[model samples]
Target chain A: MTAHPDMHETESSVREFSVSPERLRLTPEAIERRIGYGDESAPDNVRAAIEEMLAVFDSADPFRCGFRILDPGQVAFHPDRIVCGKVIFRTGSIIGRGLKGCSALALLAASAGPDLSERGRVLISEGRELAGYVLDTIASECVEQCLEHLESELAAATASWGWRLSNRYSPGYCGWDVVEQAKFFSLLHENFCGITVRSSGLMVPLKSASALVGLGENAERKDYECSLCDREDCIIRNDG
Target chain B: MKETSSILQSIAQCIERGKVNRASPYPPDLRDRDGADELVRRAIDLGIDPQEILTDGLMTGMKVVGEEFRAKRIFVPEVLMAAKAMTAGMEHLRPFFASSQATHRGVMILGTVLGDLHDIGKRLVGMMVEGAGWEVIDLGTDVAPEDFVAAVERRPESVVGLSALLTTTMMNMKETVARLKEAHPETKIIIGGAPVTVAFAHEIGADAYAPDPPGAVDFLNSTVAEI
Candidate 1:
């Protein structure tokens, strides 16, 4: 529970850490107000501030490597990395939840086009695509911590179930809705780990993630999921 | 209610009203007076056993909040306030609980299923469950199947709860639940959070599903009784 000596001085120090816990209590009301401002322009002062801070994000590298696919819809993309595993996972995932649960939906919402490629590929993103990729690194770090804490508890749950995990994948990864997240959420019953979309399909926990990984037998296909990806050019996507 | 009953009842009322302290401006009616924290402390100094203080005072307060949340009379922020009030009372007894000087109602291992990383909902559940007298082992978010199975192995009879906030990750809950059942038949599994339903709970082969914290506590009480 001890903070690393210079942890407070590190770049990882985001807004949450700057406030005292007594003053830092986040509220649902705040989240509700912030949830669907995707297309709304930031207030002038806010825009001025964010554009400055956005650079920290813009200069960032792709998460070691990343990829593209909206699953079955053949639109949007998600680039991921295992970063760390077998113990704990420290990772982050990023994408605009906009008016849909996944960016794939966002692209679909704004796009009207056909794929010349037989595989259903389309170009919808603005240039400087690498900026979008930086979020994956943050996601990987966040995920790594989540996995670590989970592992500690699981170690106590089954007295050692002797099971491991499969690499994480999304529904649309192979040809699923990556768009109809509502379907998969209904199945989880936690609504993608307890977050959900509005009537318009905007996901709450704006920067959160939803993935699918198998156990034992299915995980053996990790490499299969990797090689079959649509963003074959993505340099950060975990090949394993 | 008599003096003791009134004191306990007051605690529950304050919690339901979201009055945190003597100075809290919330529930303007209760302005400038002791809330759960002060009342709970006074109850302790008056010679009440800490455990009864918890079950009768703090737990009762939490029960009201949990019910309100279930009824949609309140949402996450309000529920969180009530929980914070409950914790204010709980902080007084942490050492006792830690020393086995007080008993935790039961143990719950909770987490968000793998491929999902939303923790607010899961954290709320963990906090409220812990405040309600259970020993909560929170695994944060994005938990994998092996993690669930492993935790069960360590605490054979403990209850397990899974959370998922995304549709994509929710499917992983079924995979996780299936894996846990395959590994430990006796482990009681409960699933909850925004998109969950009792029907979906059954679909995953889970033993129970609570839409909110109180329902989970009720199921836990039953599970403990059966033991």
Candidate 2:
């Protein structure tokens, strides 16, 4: 391939994350904005703060992963190779269940690429290219950490029946709704997404996504291939 | 060519000075002044050419900030302030832009890459490109290689700009560039943001690595000249 003319830039990752939390003194001013901590003065907020940042930290960590591709017809999508879609479910509360499902869907979309067999499985892109280097690492890690958090939370929430989650998929960018995103978001965890919906249902921090994850029996798994899906606007859906 | 004494010179000064309109309060002492918007309109009404206004006035102000930004003399906040000033000036000239009397610096496609959502750098490039007289098509944050490629298919001759704030994502710049080349070989690519450097720009085969928006302007000016 002919090389682009300006490909001469050297990549430099940021130097801030090197310091251990113990070596550094925690200033309220410093950590507050870092984690998007709302009302530092609120009681029980530090736990919330920890929950928020630690969840991001967990998501950014390299996630233990597993994948398999079923026949294209076995999934819910057409042959659009770029769609990242899934269904999610949990044993108990609706919100926690949806949150777990949605996060997995986001991971499937944002990180999963394509399996080598072409049968269809979660695939990671060559690398996450969200923005700049530091920003991408930060966002990618946040997503990974979110899945870990959701998994643990779902474990806690389950009392009777075990829950199962399919893949995660967002709207508008795909064949999903540019409108009705609010209802989709109602099923997510915002602080972890680093964005919140306002009274009008607009997501703050601007950059965010929502998706549907179906919950069902293990035999009922419809491990959908993005290629089989038809959402063209997907930022993650790409085989071309 | 007309001498620099054309009405375009005054219009350029208005933009550089952030004078939006006569009644605007910004630039405190210039209060009750007719800023770039009015100045540009008057110049147009008086038969000063639109292209002249763009090249001479608007481009001049943006070029100044681009230089300041590159030198680190002005940071993000200040450049943003200048951009605000430029916006006030450009509002009245947008129609001329659309009509083609005032041609853009060039068409440039800009965005943050996939798995990345940070938009400050891409957004900055967009402002600077717009300020520099180019019509920008922003794909917003988390742009996929396919998106960039598809957009190039739509506007074949335009320059493509890719931004990444993370080291990890910067690597993906290679793939996006690859897709562009495979599909659009003649297209030029520009890379930038905190994590990028000139050497890396070359490594990815992008045409330019602008440390700041002014460098991008300089690249486009030269590129246009080459064309």
Candidate 3:
């Protein structure tokens, strides 16, 4: 996929991508899979709860995403760390492997905003746990959808440069240490996309996601599947 | 009054089917029937021992729910519904427990370790453990290592469960476990979360590792049984 022309403006330029909740496609099957229905259809109560949550989902705040493209000089790959500009991310082997052979990097941060996560938390506290869980799943799906949308845009933006983008890899996944989040955010504008990493490495709003997309003419474009992760206890693995 | 065995069986059934009360419209097949709420109340009014209701009724049904969940016969929504039903019944036993007429199998102190804000998984494990008739003291998310140590200090017999979804936070889990272990070496600590594994559990000196809610319930129950 080719990167959009406008996305290649400058190496240090941080661009915002507007993705509306309306743009997100929350499929019933995807929700079912996440909530542990497996291949079976969700029960009536589950279906009703999902419908209710979906009906009010638009009331949540708008989603936000921002990205900065780093040139080859600004990006350096190591077996144990990835240096983006002056910031060094100790991503370990899993992330280092993915960034191998990359000439540039697209650092992106995306969030479902705070409203949905807050609403879900409130619902759980009120004992509407089933509905709360459904909302949580929806919020997570929203972030994933936002990331997917941004990935496509990045794809179209870099394709002209003959750059192939690998799948997005986020901190706290594939053995990447989340402590590197501080360095990750340093590459972006202050509170870029309205997301902030706490001292604990937790992004405020609780539903935010960040990742690095390696871009190079021959960047293998490896699909970092969750199954490859040995953490058998990982939620995504259990959800599947 | 209904036969004691029959009432207890009904209470178990209500819990298993997620029937909360006669007013609850779930499980369509059991509509209008006396649910855990009514059945448990009736059992108590009949002078049946509260301990029996807890063991023969709530725990009995929750055991099945845990097994079904482990076997994947049911999922989160179903388990959640069942926990609701179990909670409805447990409400009736609260006074008895307070009066020392009934007792929890064991106490569990659970939390998402320091630096981790993720809590849904921890809450799920708490609900399952509570449904299994353990008293769960949930410390919520981003709990400090000292907080865990202090919690276990309050209830020395309590088993601690540390949870974290992020790999970075797993370091915090290790720290929490070490602090708890240092303070109370006898304290049994169990750890679980998306990024947590048996190897990590071993690395951090945790007493056990549970991959899912049922696994947590099973681990806690087994520990108490051993005691």
Model 2, runs deviating above 4 Å: A1-240, B1-7
Candidate with top DockQ is: 3
iRMSD (1 decimal) for each model: 14.9, 16.0, 1.8
User: Model 2 over residues A1-240: C-alpha lDDT tens digits?
Assistant: 121212222121000011222322234334433323334432132334334444333333232221112222222332232222343222123222233322122221112111111111111122111112223223434434334444333333321224355544444333443334444444333342344444333344433333444433331233444565443433345464
lDDT of 1 by residue, A120-216 (tens): 1111023211122222222333333333333333223212333334344443434333444454344332432335654323344443344443222
DockQ of each: 0.02, 0.03, 0.64
TM-score of 2: 0.50
Error (Å) of candidate 2 at residue A67 is 33
Instruction: Summarize candidate 1's per-residue lDDT along B1-227 as a digit string, tens digits.
Output: 27777787887787777667786665657878898778888877777778887888888878877877777555554665676677677878787787776788789999988866666567667867876789888877778899888988898768999987544577788989899999998788999866566778889899998766777778887888888
Candidate 1 residues lying further than 4 Å off, grouped into runs, are A1-176, A179-205, A208-240, B99-101, B195-199
**What would the per-residue lDDT of candidate 2 be over residues B28-111, giving only the tens digit for each residue?**
667787777777777667776777777777787777777767765444544544565667667767888778767776799888
Better DockQ candidate (1, 3): 3
Number of clashing pairs, model 3?
A: 10
Worst 10 residues of 3 chain A by lDDT: A1-10
Error of 2 at A164 (Å): 46
In order, what are the TM-scores of chain A for the candidates? 0.34, 0.36, 0.89
Across residues A20-139, which tens digit of lDDT does each residue of candidate 3 receive?
A: 677786876788887778789988888888888987686677799978787676778897788865688887776677778888888888898888988988998898888898999998
Model 2 clashes, total count: 71
Give the CAPRI class of candidate 3: medium
- Reference interface contacts recovered per candidate: 0.03, 0.00, 0.74
